[model samples]
Target: MRTADTEPEPASDHDGQHFVVRLLDAWYVACQSRQLRQRPISRRIFNTPIVLFRGSDGRPAALLDRCAHRNAPLSLGTCQDGALECPYHGWLFGTDGGCQGIPALCGSQPGRGHRVPRFETQEQQGFVWVYARADVEPKTTPFVFPHVDEPAYATVRYQATSPGTLHANLENILDVPHTAYLHRGLFRGVERNKVTATVRRFAKHAEAEFVGEPVPKGLLGRILAPRGGTVVHFDRFVLPSIAQVDYALGENHVIATTALTPTRDDEVVLNSVITFKTVMPRILIQPLLVPIGKRVLAQDRAMLKAQLQRIQDFGKEQFVSTEVDLLGPHIWRLLRQAARNVPEPQETTPDLPAVFENTVELMA
Candidate 1:
């Protein structure tokens, strides 16, 4: 029943020594809205355990998974009349993490001092988002997926978890060169046509626009762009963790946006929304696109797993970037600066020339 203006104050004793404190200030999707019913579910984000459930009011709530009474996981307990009951000792807790009743007290009210830490929750774009930092109010809202619910577009949504760090997963999502080799016949072939990429970097964002690119000579291209008049491509990254790729061919357009959430240092969950506006009908396009999308995601997942394993074996990341490695370096720098709570120096002003703009030629 708490409105945005009357939100609860943050807990004072919550853990604040996370590896990336600034990253914790942002919102991350905990689960799809349809996934959370009355049953409690557990998720680990930023290496912190959390439990999510819906109250009797049909609103979602998030709290630390542990119970204050005996340190038992609350996710294992059951829901009763909008409150969570601890299975070990039957301690009833409300959405606000307040102790509602103690079974042993025989209808006596529980002490106000007994409570669990709670995180702010918001439902947007059919997903449940949780603010990671329980000790501070959220600075911003969740990132919105583009072109959602538009009448002209047909949308497909799915999630995949990769055995790689959050940065690695995000970098892979926006990297275009890997698609030619890794996806091979499924997505693109090794035609190696010279392409020009114009890259730009901002305070909390970065993007690359590709030109002079040849039409993809793959099964996907054949199906999506049969005529293939002209192709326009762009890859963009937003701070915290979001990557988007857009493709426009003639009158058809496709946009793929991914939001990355870290479950641990070496694990990440990707929630992706693929939207396209084409001449094809929704009924036919959705059925064909879903399987093809799954196949492409499976390939990326496997490669990411292999990359993580090699990095683990080598003890660290050894990466070399060339001119065509457009967005990887920029993404890393932005994340590093945000982790340290340092602002990127602004080099461009009204009187000065553009700060970072370059064109690189590469074969794809």
Candidate 2:
């Protein structure tokens, strides 16, 4: 793992090459833990095909989708006795990707070197994470969804694919200004309120804390903060690809954490886990929240698809952001730096000042 102050190796000048190289070194969410069962399932990350299945112990395992013998897809096979059996030749592979049995040999021992490439995998918070690089060990754990499985907290999970770049999708989730327009009555209205946001940028993370904000007036907002006392809001971004939005109103609190997994240059998968602690029972809260949350996500997905189509038609992006676009520029910078494998300054001590800090007024 590279440290904050360490110098990066010479990276390719080509943006696409840099993107592939840098992103392959990190861990990405492959699928929900419940999705993987007795049969093999296929997924793609960074355009690389992968197969996921459960071992005999019921633990998740990930491997390159191709079979070592004839390049057939392992996902087309079946799982028997904790080993993946190739459909073409009935070869058996263990969780570690080592070929354990060869039906053709009739009880003969398989060669030690015959195996498929396997990636590191772990199950956390009901999601299965797979490290992209097969040889390199993961330096950090998967991002934890806040307040999940905690007492008095109602959780809802959502998954969707957006036709946008990773950066664009992340920025859309962490951007606040769009909520007032794109989300309109469903999430936030076109109401104008002068709120001060203190933006802070760090090496691998960025956050904006808002003050003097009024309670939201949208449909969901009305349901969240009906009494409308004081509202404490925050939007944060974690490096490589995670965004979190937190809202606190006295005893009521809501947190939405989204993790982005890029499948291609123009396609990305969003896995969002929302946890809220309010004066409502889980049974009632979940039933009411799922539809509203789905609507909000659908709105964002349509907007991103249109945005991506416009950019494609124009042959490039021509975005002009203002000061109110708090986390967009910061997220872009961090992603670019990460793509180049360049390290920024880390927060060494609690008293250390932020790399960049500013207060801006915006209407929510």
Candidate 3:
């Protein structure tokens, strides 16, 4: 229950610099655990190239993609015996990025000054996370989905790349009204119901609760809730870049939590975990769940690509907002302040009038 007040401040700028580095000191989803293989895999995060490989004991390891000797890509090299051998000069490097052997010289020095930069990496919740700054430890734990480990809940994992900024896609997932149009038939029914949502912001997180939403008439509705009843939905955002949605119908609840990380200046990698509790065995249900989840994400991916294209063509964003834009503005402000290493203004007044219940009407 740590509020923004207790959260550590973002990394401070050095040498009189004003802006704090955005990804430094944060843990970002580098790739799914399954994506790593016996061969080294190259991944780029925060616009920096990194290579991931498995050690001799099969533990995950990561390092800067470049070899210190010739600046060749270490990812093209071979991995064996918990060490990576550079393809160019047959220089073998251990899991710690230390030079271990040199094929060319029998008595070559294997120690000092011949090493590549290494990064801190951890595998959790089916994803491998890379800490952006080698000097800073992650302050937050990687997100985990509820019921993922429970025997009664069926879980489906998915990954997608969006041609949009981290801010853009984060806002898209929490946006409720967009589903009726952008994801029609797939997520929402043709019928438009006036839904009300109450939004509140805390120190490090924010949430929107939707009330008066009728049972959806789409395919998802039939799968999640056949007998129509009032649906309780919550859209939430956590610090850094985590967005999740929960749909509750009586005792059964379906949840999808997505962790987004910036792979480039204009692109983000999405790692999603979808889980639900049901009477049926998960083995029978997972096959049906995967396809539907993929379809919904496909629609979102397409829409975000189009939006990014529009921004590129116009050279800037032309946008307007109403009170219903409950979370977008807040998210933008948080990013802006974090970039400058400034404290959140609302952190001091947790019970401010604006932080309390307020509702917005939208068609769902």
Candidate 4:
């Protein structure tokens, strides 16, 4: 097997075309994690096997899982001297993935040719991200929640290994109109309030701000929103990943935040942390709201899990989209462009690809 350095990296563009290549560059994905078990945790990207290990520094690191000696799984071995000692013959490898110790031969080294591949690792925000592409510097900061990370904040994590394409789920979460039907009791009210809204697009961003609300009804409107007054719902979708809808509940009062992450193509981990920036005592708010916030997530899971199964059976070719599914189409186009070997133009460059209209306009 080729060493990490020897392996040729996938270039952003074989031609001069620039597309957003997400997988190649190293990205700081998490900020917090308790140690996992001593055993290796298996992960696959599109189906390639990898093993995650905690080095002697008590930090998380990953390897190709295959040992260099005879391709024995290094994870099958035990951790000694801060490295994995091969169970088969006691060949130990360092965090850099080079064979460091050969037990039976005390004075002899395994030599320079013996090494395993190392993957770039960072633990932030409570998760892990592996860079599968090559020749790119990391452009993203560690995953963070500025408000939640502060003192006097209480947060909870919900991790579920969901099934189905992440693209479908991202669009579903961002599609506000569907809640009137798909999530009748949870997200939106059963009654349809007629409000006309316009969608304006500019350079990879779009927003639908709701106005003239004869007012929305149901649980959120009742308990969370201002009583007998107009409330504005501004749903914003930040580039690459992140969607947040802030319902104006008076000055500086925001109702919710939902972060949907693609753990894999067929699975996603949706972590919803709902907090109010109030000086209220923890005893008062913790008991009153934590259960309700978790219940909101449970409501989504019941519906989405069923939808996922149905889609997997039908496969990708049969799914249909209406005018509301525009955002999803753009997401797919971008992902495909990345897979087809396109490089991304820097934020400073405004050059347009011939396949796209202008960098500023949405291709209609």
Candidate 5:
């Protein structure tokens, strides 16, 4: 099998165009690992149709969904002998996307070599990621959910699709003040709090930390912070659309990371994994945790949908960022740099601030 470095000639799709070529080169989560079984499942990322399936050896394979001959969707066909069979003409395509057998031709070779685009796919951290570029490898491995595999931590995973830009979702996850108002009774703080936050930015990453915040009074606090103390909250934005938020309540900590992948310009697939190290046993508290987490996610989804609709109608974004919107600017800086395959200079407007602190006042 050829490595991702050896790309086939670009697919005839619009993605081959120069304008979007760079964006397509980056790796994006195509679907959850559990979703692809022996039978094929079709999904589209960056507007490229892909059919994902597991070969007889149990490794995942991704192929352009269109059949080489009739352009029939290979996903509608069946998997046999470790290859996908085109239902329309009974043509079999091997894992490498090369046409192998044609029923009509019987032992005779089908003239004119043909193959569909096969994308580079890797499965890690419970998700399947694909590089849309016909012949490029991802610069790094998929984002790691370190706690998920750790024996000491218990993790709960949640997924949803939001009708918003990936940047919008990233901003929402890292925004702290919204928790009080948007998640009033669930994860918000009750009293007006004066919080001190520091935002630090580096070459390809950024983070914000909030200090002197009171223990959350919402359901999350009830379960994870039964014995209250100061809560130290931190938010970070990793390159290529990943947000990590951690809340430390004394010795117990609640950490969640959300990885966002753009399915389209206005739609993003979000995978959120929340892990906790608490006094209570994980198996005992897992059930309660999922519902509360879901409640919070639902609220975020509603707000994002409303925000997307407004942007769609207005045809532009003109929102203002304040001192509290510390993560937003840095997120854009790194993401835009990565998209352009450019490295952010050590000094520039919105340059990585080694460390910067501010005070934000909010009425919960």
Candidate 6:
């Protein structure tokens, strides 16, 4: 059996916390095409703010965001060949974030003092990802969908950031019971009572299987929820922080990863990516398919964001946990643990691969 103390402590009760060290990875809401088109997008990557700009030669550059001369946001400046021009003093920094030119002073050479710190960055799957701490690197490869990765998936991403918590959103999807009620007309139809499910966990991940029904209970009930083989859905919490969702929607096996990086104490920006595996040839149907997928995705995001805001405004009240709340509470615990991923100011980046909580300990 488990008690409250044995489970990971909530961030709300933890005395001090930082975002960078807590999560193993962070995803930037970047558009590779859009990023390359004009000026770079200026976004805060977790606790550390950063400036990204494309040079005249069209190479992407990332700087520590603060100008070398003074602590000013360099993103508010212009771009030269692989360099960022600081708006504050008009100091131009190269792709490596080295100060290239100082407009005010005539310099014999751009001294070492003119350089700004740089971070590790990768532009993939039409987004940019930044690693704040220099020493850390990814253990497993980032999830890239072959279908989307194909030069075909016609993707256009838009982000809506709110003052919501990361754990709150992850719980929404992992908690399948909510999907029946919340996304009734959308993700699923009206009748959900036909589907029977049971959940199991491993290491830091938890999964639920629709063991009973593959057919639906309503008009389409028998078609979707037949006398069930199992449809497995597992969620793994990859530490400092990352979440993986694997589920099958008919012929489509979908996997989505959302890395929740903290921007501020009360807010976390989710960098979510989805990959689909389908037997259908994507070329002919992709134009129509991507939009359908995007619409469904948009619906889920709305539910999560709105529910989070509501809880913030009204404040949390105590709830009686039940057998049905099993998957939801179990998920809440794991995500809360990950949300504490930021490293402490004094600690060095951890050498170990991201750790997962003991699921048996949780469910016991």
Q: Which one is best on TM-score?
A: 2
User: Candidate 3 residues 1-364, lDDT tens each?
Assistant: 2233223233343212111235566778888888887889998887889998989888788889999889999999999688998999988898788899877886865857688888778888778888877634566666666787887677788888887777788889988778888778867877888888888766567788998887788877777667778898899887778899999876567899988888876788888888887544557666877888788788888988888777777665655666667676566656656666666555635455444345678777
Query: Which pairs clash in model 2?
Result: none
Q: Which candidate is the best by lDDT?
A: 2
For candidate 5, give the lDDT: 0.76
Q: Model 6 Cα displacement at 318 (Å)?
A: 5.6
Candidate 6 lDDT, tens digit per residue, 1-364? 2345233344464323321123434434433445555575666644567777776666566677788788878877777666677778778888776777877776535766668877666766666666655434544444353355554233323344544445555555456566555555544566443444455543355555554434323222223223433454555544334556665646545566666565644466665556555445545433543455456556766775576566556554223455544455555555554455533223322443322223221210
Cα lDDT computed for each candidate against the true fold: 0.81, 0.82, 0.76, 0.54, 0.76, 0.53
Would you list the rank order by TM-score, best first?
2, 1, 3, 5, 4, 6
Candidate RMSDs in order: 8.0, 4.4, 5.4, 8.8, 7.7, 6.5
lDDT minimum window of 10 residues, candidate 3: 12-21
In model 5, state the lDDT of residue 247.
Answer: 88
Show the lowest summed lDDT stretch of 10 residues, model 6. Answer: 355-364
User: After superposition, which runs of candidate 5 have C-alpha atoms over 4 Å from their true positions?
Assistant: 1-22, 106-112, 347-364
Q: Give the TM-score of candidate 1.
A: 0.90
lDDT of 5 by residue, 1-364 (tens): 1112112122222222111222676677788898888789998776678898878787888899999999999999999978898889988888777887888885747545788788888888888888777644566666777688787888889888887776778888898879889998788656776777777766767888787888878888888878889988889988777899998888888899988877776677888889888887777678998898788889999998898777667655655555666677667656666666777556333543553334454343
lDDT of 3: 0.76
True-structure RMSD for candidate 4:
8.8
- Give per-model TM-scores: 0.90, 0.91, 0.87, 0.71, 0.87, 0.69
Worst 10 residues of 4 by lDDT: 355-364
TM-score of 4: 0.71
